[model samples]
Target: MNTFITLAIVLIALSFVYTWGAAASRRVASQTGEKLHSRPPYYGLYLVLWCAIPAAIIFIVYSLITPTIETVIIQSYFPQEVLNDAAELANQTRQVESIAGGFGMFGEPAPYQVQAAAALKNVEWIGKMALVALIAVAAVAGTLVARTRISPEFRARNRIETAIEMLLITCSAIAVLTTVGIVLSVLGEAVRFFTFVNPIDFFLGTSWNPRFSTTGHGGQGDFGLLPLLWGTLMITIIAMIVAVPIGLMAAVYLSEYAGPKFRFVAKPMLEVLAGIPTIVYGIFAAFTVGPFLSTMGDAVGLDINATSAFTAGIVMGIMIIPFVSSLSDDIISQVPQSLRDGSYGLGATRSETIRRVILPAALPGIVGAFLLAVSRAIGETMIVVLAAGNSPVLTANPFEAVSTVTVTIVNQLTGDTDFASPQSLVAFALGLTLFVITLCLNVVAIYIVRKYREQYE
Candidate 1:
């Protein structure tokens, strides 16, 4: 039987056993004229917990160790010549397992490999049977022990609650540990990258040319930050210029001026922009906006690349409009009606009241929305990759093709480059730099919001 199906059957049988145990305990209590410490259901739950938890733990441990044990056993059967090198042994082991599993072989298998494949099938079958048998024995033993403990004085509720609390704590710790692991892994790789490329040159040099070398030494590349940084900032500035004013104005109209019916219809329609995938925006920018801008620039006696910073920035700005609009709208709507009313009492016009009273009250949240949109624009890859002509150049002109740090990272890590090479390692360093920049932006946003809240309150 399938292992999962077997597990399900075990759980179902345990449930019935627990039900019978709880019913028998209640009957015994009635006969003895004694009240149970906890309810009948608590006794059933406690029995189920005991029957399932230990058996599940044993099954999990066996499953995790089985693959390594099987690989070792199979390796022992291989010819000494095949097992001379550790890497070759691992590759051959994988090939044998694949053949056993009925996958296509890379080449004709040797006599020993064929024998090992057959043995692998047998070992796997035996392991599964052993696992099922052990789990069944554990479940039966736990059920009997738990039934004996389910007397009048047993504190079933406390035990169940403690188990649940520990489970929750374990889940929370896993999440925190996973995040820490990712950050540390990236940080370690970035340190290795910095060791090859001088920190000053990487940060301050103006060019970015990663000349990859097969031989693991550092490449003959500029490895500069200024060009990519300038490109990223330039695109982000253009995007903000396009997004902030328009999105804020839309938010103002929806919150203060638009009627209820119009607001309801328009709000959701506007937010639909955020749901479209970034790749779709990239396509639109590459095919439509970039060409149009290039043509328009020629007509106006200006030089513009078909794929340029201006094209990517404008499309990215349009893509982030919903983020800005939705957040700013909610913040503007949250400003107290009393503020508007007080402004009206001071003989201010509706526009004047919104400008002088409501906007000031919502300024902190609006700033936060703008920062979020800016961050989104900075992290965007597909839009910039498709539209921004991937040229790493230090330039002030938005009409020229340029590349950002994210694009450079993608380029560096694209193929089968060795991780030890500076070309590949530089991607991690770029990633770390981006992380730090975003972190600082968040800190500044938090500080500003807190200061504004203090004054407003």
Candidate 2:
């Protein structure tokens, strides 16, 4: 059956099971005239959890193993020579899978390949059927086990709560482990890259033209970091220049000055800019803002490229405006009213009160918000990719076309390059560097924000 169809069936079955469980629980409670540990709905929820969890686990396990089974069965039909060569084996296996799925075969498939494809289809169908059966079996077993215990004496509420707690803990552990896995994977790839390119050269060098590098002096490529690093910082600084004042002023106006009606309407309208996809922003920058700037620059007797650090930065700054405005508004609003009241009692004007009391109180959080915006700017990819003309040259001019770490990472990882080569692996190094930079910035921002909270709260 189709995945969606199966899911729908499962959902319908679960709903029926829930109704059955609740009705049965209500009958048990009423017939025996005993106070239930929980209401009928809680017992239903407990049964639903028991049925779903085991079924989900069985489905997941079956899905994971199906591919391996297909591979083995397909390999059994292929010649030893094809199986001996890893590339040939992979290619043939892909062809088999494609033909089995009724696509990707340009012409008639070979006899053995067709046979293998047929077998693969059989195996996949068997796997799917087995998975469906296993899920049903597991769900029924779990339901029966739970059903026997579902009496007025059973603490279904306590059991359901405990299950929910475990689920939450599992989710937390999965998130932590995922982060750890990413760090380890990037570090491992970076180590592989470092073996080919000198760590010092990769980190400190000024050039960044990456191609195939021989294992010779400095790994034979200008895999420098400075040029890309400079581009990233330049664009980020320009973004901050554009974003900070405007976003903060917007926040201040909304929180401290604007009428409630205007604030309600205007704030979301401003934030709508943030909700626009970065790719769309990039396209706008490239096609609209970039040309607009270039025309304006030419009118003013300046030579500005359509795609430059300035263009990308301007668009990125616009994109991150809500990050600053929304966050600053929250922080600013959180400042205790007593501080404003005290400032007013001391014969302070609104502006003076804001400058001396409210701002100082909320400074750390505002700083944190700025840093958050900075982090967002540094990590942004599409705006730089499409707007910032891909020139990996170190320069101080805002008008110059420049490439950033994120764009470089995308360029390096694209195409059929060998992952073991420094050319491809450099992407990981660039990614790791960004991760570290953002991580450090986040850590510092969090520390500052927390300290401010301690004083304020």
Candidate 3:
């Protein structure tokens, strides 16, 4: 609440500074009887940037460091035993912060905890005041310095544009750094997992019975990836079999044949599938689709499980249709009208033009979209979890239940388990594998998109 109030104060200060700077600039221009380099609003925005940017940096830096500082300070009051254990120290710090903020603990805290909480409250109060003072100084100094610089020759527009460009670059850098962090963190944990289990056995061994598995030195139980990997592939292939052709045809019809009114009505309705929760899809598959498929199989003298990969895949494909259709429609629509006109002038029919000209032109983007949808399919958890039936058997029969890498990852990590055990560590290994696969898919998709985009350009 204090931080929010501080933010409000900073915003109000910035607004005042902007109004003052804009009026001051206009006054100077009128007095000098010279043309202003940029509009008054540009000057106002320029001053707002100056007043807000430094103060934001200070506030952010203080906000990030203050908790760690408080934790360390409070730990000085912790009992020696608590201080000795990293986890205990962390728990104590959380308790102190909670108690200091008047949230009240379940029981009366120790004398040392009371002392620590009091000290923490004071430290937080001091930190907030210091933050406000720093922000005031930065804002006032920026307003004074920037307001003085607002003259007829000041290039406020150019400066503001450059500032916007820098902001965009900073956002891009943060995205890249986040990806790097994820890869490194997953890779580190996976390396630890490898120390406990053989990579070859984990990848090639057929069985996936990780329960009651012996840890350390030589792994005892089967920790195989083949069953999960095969199940994942089966579901993905089945989904693509359903999604690709249907989605592509839908895109073609919508882009080429549908009237404007129909297209307008249909597109959002189709995209609505994208917004429906996967959990709801899981329920739909489990209760409705699964039994329906099993009965259909029974009518045809074929065995089928109520919750199998086939059931999950059909629903998963339906879920991803929007991804393929929406992107393919946009890509096909982007094909130059001149090309279509030329095809028509050459006496080709609509279907021929669509097949020979438009599809070929949009192939790269369509392929990219397909790969992205495949990635989406591979990453799906809830639908697969509920519909794929928790079976880790290595089997080729779609009628039988089988598990997936994602399902296994969820199972391995769920509930209270010792992280030191190989069972838990295997989750990290599975995660890294999934990450690598999806990353490769994304990279290929990006390459295809960029390569053809540049060629078209």
Candidate 4:
């Protein structure tokens, strides 16, 4: 419903943009003998952006904050008798919402409804109507204003170009803001988790049993970080061991050695590996690769479980191959042709040229690719959930069962889990840690890519 309303608003705003641009063009044509500076479409885009961008931002902000505001308002609706009791406060607010909802506040009618239902309906209606009206008005005003400014002497082309540049920068800023928002949300939940579990105990302790209870009993929770870290590192290292060499060789062959036809066929075929979903990879790892490894281990007189870290890591590595290969290929291709020619002119073989020259030139990019691949392998959930045993144990053996942070999070948050409980809160803490690690890796990737660009350019 919200999506449909947003789309409708955008369409209406677009109509206004067109109207504004046409009016401006007509005015300009009347004012001057010369043709308009640019096409009508560009003028329309300028007006549309002016009307739509600020409105879009407001809509997004309102959508995010509305839930929190509603929660506070509903809490305020509860009588003081309910409010004084911390335990009752949550339940009573829920009951109030249930009563309001039953009265057709959000859906169909039921029994006991109140003024809250009407209030909610009013709020929803006001939000949609206001947004649409504001966008339309802004669009009309922008069109008229731009048209008034348009004349033979006016630099419409320059103005339009500058506006587009600002829009692009705004888009980039939105992406960055979105990332920051995610991190902030994770941090907020993690802070809540830390309130129950001591930060030191959460970080350093070996045991990770998050079972907080209201029953003031002998058993408290143990939110440790070490065992999960060990498991994550081991699995990630095993995955990198499998992925790095194969992905690099595939990239090298495709980018430099293969003929055009071979490259065309092989590149997409190799990328087909990436197109296969992670869940499919998980099932394959659990049912197929696990058994195959067990059989091989049995013949070799090594004890290995069906659901082992090695199995999960190997499957994850296969999933990450395209990431490494694709990035490496781009970097390798970016290496100047003159360098390879110089190497060949110095009597270097193709293999020697690639080994000594091309690889060196693309080292930063290759490192960046490897870092990205590692981050991916670290964050992979399904493969580990299926094949890597969910035993958060600190072990060095690849053939042994282990679990990663993502698997632990999935386990804790699955099915009907209490959100306020320590178990669910732990998931947020793990998520924050995961986000931090990935952010660091991304920073490194950007730095490496920039350094590589500087070196080559």
Q: List the residue pairs that clash in candidate 4.
A: none
lDDT of 1 by residue, 1-457 (tens): 7779977987689779879778967986888788888888888888888888889899889989998999888897898888898888989999899989999487799888899999999999998889878888998899889888877788887887898899999999999999789789989999998888899999998878788555423455678899999999999999998999889999999999899999999999999999999999999999999999989999999998889999999999999999899999999999999888888998999999988788888989999999999899999999999999999999999999999999999999998889898889999999889988999999999998998888779
- Candidate 1 lDDT for residue 211: 87
Question: Which segments of candidate 2 are over 4 A away from where they belong?
Answer: 212-219, 295-303, 336-338
Worst 10 residues of 3 by lDDT: 212-221
Per-residue CA lDDT of candidate 4, range 40-94, in tens?
5666666666666666666677789877766676665556676799987776556
In every candidate, how many clashes are there?
0, 0, 0, 0
TM-score of candidate 3 to 2 decimals: 0.92
Report residue 225 deviation for candidate 2 (angstroms): 1.1
TM-score of each predicted structure versus truth = 0.85, 0.91, 0.92, 0.79
- What is candidate 1's CA lDDT for residue 296? 95
Instruction: Assess each prediction's global lDDT (C-alpha) against the native.
Output: 0.89, 0.90, 0.89, 0.81
Writing each residue's lDDT as its tens digit, candidate 2 over 205-273 gives 998878646744555578989999999999999999999999998898899999989998998999898
147-266 per-residue lDDT for model 3 (tens digits): 889999999989999999999999999999999998898888888888878899888878888877366335446798999999998899888989999999999999999999999999
